[model samples]
Target: MEKPQPVVVKVVTPEDREEAYRIRIEVFVTEQGYPEEGEIDHYDAVATHLILVFPTSDTPRRAYGTVRMVTLPDGTGKLGRLCVAAKLRGMGAGALLVRALEKEAKEMGLSAIVLSAQVHAKGFYEKLGYGFPDGGVEYMDDGAPHVKMAKTL
Candidate 1:
């Protein structure tokens, strides 16, 4: 199969809300078996910024992956709500989203970006130049172990 061209990344708007939510529902609720209610919470509206990916023109521009960015009072940025469609894993969608978020952060005058990466995915984030803040792991959401990683933009 032909590889997908580099995805065009953009800031999610009101029009993209449903697409983003649908992607999340597919990845988190259906594939990962997360409870629908728990997968989406209040933080979505108040503290999240979504990155929408249109990976190809031939196919519908579905929300293949999304990462939420939150700006702290000190002007730092936090990335959360990361999800990628199961069928599209190993295609660099998550990394592209992170890079896009970093660009957005730089534009926002933030010095760095942070994320609580699931332990299994730490290597993926590390390869993209993020370093773990704490030496050990943290079981933050449910029993999933995660490491807080960050990169200075």
Candidate 2:
């Protein structure tokens, strides 16, 4: 059997931001029922965005995943808005996106990375070495339960 081709990940440029936004809209807004207006925020202007693309010979490269990272005032990296195209979930695209974001965080000299993970994906973040804070607190965001998870770089 042929191995699947690896997806390419890159820091978003002016041209690529739209693709990242599109994927986020599909996952967070249309599919997950997040508020359309709240799906975007001021952070988008200052954050560093990442995009994952699958290459093809017959058609344009397809954008399948996205995530954004922002350096917090306390000097850690905050990762958010991570999403993979529905058709590509469970195929390693999400992991690839997280790895890319972690590398970017390291390159930015961040001491740690933190994220508010949806409750359903807590195990997924745990597998990637992120863990909830001591005492295990949960909070609600946009009506969905979430936990704060972090990993030291």
Candidate 3:
């Protein structure tokens, strides 16, 4: 039997926010070919950002995934920019990031959490309890197809 990797997800501190950005760019921009222009947006300034890290004795720590929650006008938390390193995709990193944000949203008294999930990743989000609302439609974001989904908290 093998031991599971130690994964820690935390609120990104002001100084460490850049680490989150780096992970986002590495996954979204560099690996997925998303234009760098719109990767970081105005919402990021006010949104609560989370960073998922893998800690090892060989080094202090390394950020492996990231996600953010932006409170919408309807008071629902909007989950966006979820990115986990390509190498760590199946290691449960993305789910950890989403769960961390869900915990934060619940603490903030949010009724639900919404997201525009990339079409291909829809099943991943679905397994986490997010679903498309009535009349939800596919939309384009950053040159990719996305559909809106929400999960009640």
> Whole-model Cα lDDT per candidate?
0.76, 0.84, 0.84
lDDT per residue (tens digit) for residues 45-146 in model 1: 765556456555634456777877878887889888788877668888788788888888898899998888888888998999999777756676656777
Put down candidate 3 lDDT per residue, 98-153, tens digits, no spaces: 98899999999999999889999999999999989955689998778989999999
| TM-scores of all candidate predictions against the true structure | 0.84, 0.91, 0.89
User: What RMSD, rounded to one decimal, does every model reach?
Assistant: 2.7, 1.9, 2.1
Show the colliding residue pairs in model 1: none
Q: For this target, which candidate reaches the highest TM-score against the unseen true structure?
A: 2
Count steric clashes of candidate 3: 0
| Candidate 2, run of 10 with poorest lDDT | 54-63
lDDT of 2 by residue, 1-153 (tens): 776565656654555777888889999999998888987899999998888885556334457889999899998999999998888889888888898889888999999999999999988889899987654599898899989999999
- Which lDDT value does model 3 have at 67? 89
Q: After TM-score superposition, what is the CA distance of residue 67 in candidate 3 from its true location, in Å?
A: 0.4
- Of the two candidates 1 and 3, the one with more favorable TM-score, higher being better, is 3
TM-score of 1: 0.84
Off by over 4 Å in 1: 1-6, 55-60
